[model samples]
Structure formats: structure tokens, C-alpha cells
Target chain A: MSERAQEGRTAEGPTAGEGRTAGGGHGTGGGPGRVLVAVYGVFALAAGARAAVQIARQFDEAPLAYTLSAFAAAVYLLLAVALGRGMRRLALVACGIELAGVLIVGTLSLVDPEAFPKATVWSGFGSGYVFIPLVLPVLGLYWLSRRR
Target chain B: MIGPLATGLIVFALVIALASLLTTALNKSMGTVLLVALGVLEIGLLVQAGFVVAALAAGEGPTDTATLIGYTAGTVVIPPVAAFWGVGERSRWGPAVIAVAGFAIPGMVGRMLQIWQGMG
Candidate 1:
């Protein structure tokens, strides 16, 4: 997808009335865009699976934390979709939400360790995942903004 | 949890990651050589997995079976996934993806070993 397409721009390029693409337009065979989609897909799978397992294994132990994990995973999936479909507005929203989630969760987990009896994907700023959770949002936002 | 073999793998992965990062920084894309290196790394991981399984069969396994298996399996998955994504771009980011995957392997492996040793 072209950079304009990534920003949810119409054929006229960044003009008004360009409805967000329902899905990413990235699977066009081969390119940097496809590679980005693939990486996002990997994160989607990892976060989704991890959250599912956490929720399944012990939802009662820490409902908030696990639910947050699920939420983060959902956001990641959405971000992947947005980027893939070249839905710039949706991608921007999702990436913004991701950044917010990481910051909020990161702060809360640090402030009150007891609240997070179990670690979520964003706990300790995603220390468990080697801080990629924290870093990914920044990259996503940068990628999106560059198109704008 | 921190065996020599596992450590060796982690270090090797880190080295590869550094190489990838440097290459990508230089605007170089992942090419045939890097792809072959990744393949070789995958083969090495499979061999390591086989060794671990054999050791377990001999009753010298790590403490946690399931987590150990999960880690072992995870290590094997990273390279191909990265390569699949990496090859398509043909840009510096292609190798960047490889770098990320390469770095992740050692950390995951180390964590798995820790779990196996009942440390985590």
C-alpha cells in the first residue's frame, strides 16, 4: 500500500470522505508493507494467544490484569488489521490506544504490585516480553504518523 | 536453567541480531547469505531440541516438562516466521525483523530453561 493509503487517504490523497478500509490492504503479494503486516500479525498472534492462556488459566486470581491483557491483545489485533488494510484513522486510533494501555498498565502495575498478583503482557512495561510491548506502540505510531 | 548449550545458543542469537541490526542500519536487506544463516540456526535449534528430548527420555529432564517443551517449540518457530516476513520486504527492515527474531530466541530459551529449572 502507498503511504497515502496508509493514512486513510482517498485516491485524491488525504482528502476528506475517505472511509476507513475495513481490512488492511497489505497482502498484495510482496513489499515492505507486507513485511510490516507480517510482523504485526506475529504480535497479534503472540499477544492474543498469551492473553487467552492467561484468562483461561486464572481469571479469578486477577481479573483486571488478565482482562487488560485481553484488551491489549485485541488492540494489537486491531492495529494489525488497520495497518494491513491501510486504514490510517483506525490504525492511528488503535496505536494511540495501545500507547495509552501500556502507559496506564505500566504505571498501575508499578504503583501497586498487589493489584497485579499475576503479570499481564503490559506488566512492568512489558518486561516479561523484553519491553517490546512498550516499544511496539511507539513504532506503530511513528509509522502511522509518517504517512500523515 | 542456564546450561552451556542454552547459553551458547543465546549468545549466538545475539550475535546474529547485532549483525542484522548493523546490516539493516547500513541500508542492507536480508539476502541469500542471511537466509542461509537463519536456516542453519534453525537446524541447530532442532538438533538442540532433539538432544533435550533424549536427555529427558533418559530421566535427566528439567523439572517442568510442559514449559520446557513450550520453550523448545517456541525457539524453533522464530526463524522461519522471521524469514517469511523478512524476505518479502527486500529492504533494511527485512533484516531488522530477523534481528528482532534472533534476539527474541535467546531470551525465550533462557526463560524456558529457567522454568525447567523451577526458577521461574
Candidate 2:
């Protein structure tokens, strides 16, 4: 049955095949790259909406955490768009910043928990998110370098 | 909002995620079984959403109704989109996309449960 779906995709797979065949289109679209884009898109939407609500509802309760959430959300959005467009340089920069942000925020949250009265997406290396926030940048960096 | 139903959906999503992940690990594309499983999950999620909406209308659910509804709507949408995108790719990552969506559904549903309880 899966074979039927596989055949269906091949029957209409110009975009997928073109993603690989089209020169200089490594990052924008392809097999693994498409997965990455999808993951990033989900994260962007999740994080962005979370930050918006947190900030709008009670910014004073945890301004730092909410702001950082907003920042992380923006980064995820940029990374998703940059990767989808195959903007290698921008994607690289975004991945680097994300790595740095997670590390810094993770450490800070651990050392001075009071600073984050509420949890941001990066808090505790995204433990609330099953640590994907910590791991995604590492994967992104590896994927980007491999593409280059 | 519905206790056992929420747990059932979460477990169902988790199982689907694990199956999809297994396919990706084996370097196989998503199969018909997985697609059908996803469709079923989506339908279950919609049913869950309907229940949540009905509960909210009766003023028996979370105080953060907006967020709860957002999560419910988002959860219902992920599976079909992932399936559509997954079928487009012919590689292991095609299943990888489904795996991600499968994982996301449980996570989102869990959050919705938490919101319904006002645990956040």
C-alpha cells in the first residue's frame, strides 16, 4: 500500500526531483532539507504564537522570558524561510545564532533560575520541548556544512 | 478536555510516530499503512477538537480558551499537511516528515490537556 503512495509521489514529483536537479538548490528543497524546512516551520509557528500570547497576556510577569521567546521564535522563522529559499549564508548565520542562544540561555536558566521567572522556549535547553531546541541547531549546522 | 480520550489520542499519536520513525530509520519511504494511520489520527484529533469546542461552549473547559482552541486547531492540521508533504518526497525523509508530525501531535495534545487543566 505504501508502494502505491510512493508511486503516486513519483508520478507527481517534479518539484522534489527538481529540488535536487536544479543547480545551487541544495538547501532550499530536497529530501532531508524538506524535512528540516517542515520542522523549522512547525517550530516557528509554535514558538512565535507562544511568545505572542505570553507577551500579550502578562509581559510584566516574565518580561525577559517572553522577550527571549519572541527572539527565539523570530530566529526559527528566519531559519525556516532561509532554508526553504536555499539562502545558505543566512541559514548558516541563523543556525549559529540559535546554537549560541540555546547554550547561553540554557546555562543562564540553570545558573540563575530567577532571571527566567517563566520558561522561554530555550529555557533549560528546551526541556519543556523534549530538548529539540537544543539538538536542532546542531543538526542544522551539520546539514548546512554538508550541503556546502 | 476529555481525559481518557486525550490519553488515547496521545498514545495513538505516539505509536504512529514510532512506526514512522522506524520506517525512516530503515530508509524506507512512508507506506500506505502509515498514511492511513495518519488519516485516522487526524480524524480522531478532529473529534477531540469537537469535544473540546463543545465543552468550551458549555463553559466547562479551560480559562485560556483561545490557546486551547489554537492548539486544537493546530493539532488537527499537522497530520494531513505532513502526509501531503511526505508523499511528495521519495526518500527516507518522506517518512521523516511524517515522523515529525506524528511526534508533534502528541506534544501539542499534551499541551492542550495542560491548558485545559490550567496547569500552566
Candidate 3:
């Protein structure tokens, strides 16, 4: 973790300078945008932590669900970083993938509960997560479009 | 782990979160009050972390020790990181970020309790 923090600090060094000059771009620099990015970051960490635990401890119990959990975590992370960095197009792409993932996974979980031995981040549109998964991408898309 | 202590931690976090949210909604830049609120909350979180670690060492926690410890450590770290970002931004969004971090602590603590109780 310390190593990762060190790497992140070094990586952020140049980008932070670039961000200063990139001024007034589509980055999530303001209040509402920062809130959205914060939510995305929270979800990323939550899903990623859950996936790590599930995979590390009980992979055999629900391999597919755990794998999907990992995937959702990755998508959340990508969207958060891209939006934070002002990569509007990349954020858009990530949000599109997230929306599709939620819809497809949510529907599949509902249609055949047995298909998922355990719940993933997108299960039932993230009911366990207060349905944020169902709504976040829509909000992301709206915010991205407005910023554009 | 410790019932009343956990409740105290959550309530404190929520109060700070609400205060931060109010600042953001009112379009105020992050202020001394907000920083003080966050500082208090971080102290509470660290105390909670200490209690959790002691309880775990006493063999009073979940079978999944790694995950439980991860959550405990994560909760303690979040406030400082959020504070750094919030203080750096100097915009309304700075408080917004702090609000998110503030809200997140309670949720993480709730989950940690669940994990400690073997609810997973």
C-alpha cells in the first residue's frame, strides 16, 4: 500500500501540473462534478474490496459472481479516474459500459436467480447497494454531456 | 464491536457529513468549521480503529480477519486523504468531497460491524 501511494504521488506529479494549464476543461473540478466523482470512487472501492474478499476466500462458491464483481469494480474505477482527469470521452465510454453491465446483469439476476450463486455489484441493479448502480451511469452520462 | 462506541462513531460521522453537505449546498468554500468537524471525526475514527484492533487481538472478531482489518484501516485513512483533497481544492466541491468521505465512514463502519459479527 505504501508502495502504491508512492507510485501514485509520483504519477500525479506531472499530471497535476498539466491539469493546472488544462484550465476550464471538462474535468470534475467543481462541487457537483466532484461529488459525482466521489460517489464513483466510493463504489469502486466498495466493489473492489468485496471482490477481493470473495475471490480470496470463497472463489469456488460463486466464481461467476465474484468475477463479475471484479469487473464492475474495474469499470467503476475507470470511470472515476477518467472523469476526474477530464477525459470526457473515456468517461463516456466507461459509463456506457457500466450502464450496459448493470442492465444486463440486473436482468439476468432477476430472470434466473440460480445463475448467480452469490450477488455481484450489479445484482438486481445493485439492490444491496441501494440501487446506486442503476442510477449512477445515467447521472454520469448527464453530467458528461453537460460538461461537453 | 463495541456497541455504544460504534454508535457514537457513526453518529459523529453523520453529523460532520451533514455539516459538510450544508456548506457545499450553500456554496461556501471549505472553512475552519468544516476542517474542525473533519478533524474531530478523524479522531473518532482512529479511536474506533484502536478499539477494533484490540478486540480482534482479544479474539473477539470475525473469522475473516484480513477483511475486517482492511476495513478498519481503510476507515482510518479516508479522512486524511479527503482532507488533503478538500483543503487543496478551495472550491465548494472541496466540502462536497469531504461530505462524501464523511458519509462513507459510517457505511464502512456499519459494514465492518457486520463483518465482525460474521454476518457475511
Top candidate when judged by lDDT against the true structure? 2
For all predictions in the order shown, the interface RMSD in Å is 8.6, 4.6, 7.9
Tell me what TM-score chain A of model 3 achieves.
0.83
Q: List the candidates ranked by TM-score, beginning with the highest.
A: 3, 2, 1
For all candidates, the clash counts are 5, 2, 0
Tell me the whole-model lDDT of each prediction, alpha carbons only.
0.71, 0.83, 0.80
- What DockQ do you compute for every candidate structure? 0.15, 0.29, 0.28
Residue B83 local lDDT, model 1: 89
Ranking according to lDDT, highest score first: 2, 3, 1
Tens digits of per-residue lDDT, candidate 2, B13-77, equal 99988998899788787799999999999999989999998888898986787788778878987
For model 3, the stretches where C-alpha displacement exceeds 4 angstroms are A1-26
Candidate 1 vs candidate 3: the TM-score winner is 3
lDDT of 2 by residue, A1-148 (tens): 3453344345334554454323323444455776887898789878888888878888999999999999999999999888767888899999999999999999999999999989998999999888999999999987787676
Model 3 lDDT tens row, A25-141: 225443366677778888888888889988999999999999999999999999878877778788999999999999999999999999997999899988988899999999999
Q: What is the Cα-based lDDT of residue A122 in candidate 2?
A: 95
Name the candidate, 1 or 3, with the larger DockQ value: 3
Model 2 interface CAPRI class: acceptable
The docking quality of candidate 2, as DockQ, is: 0.29
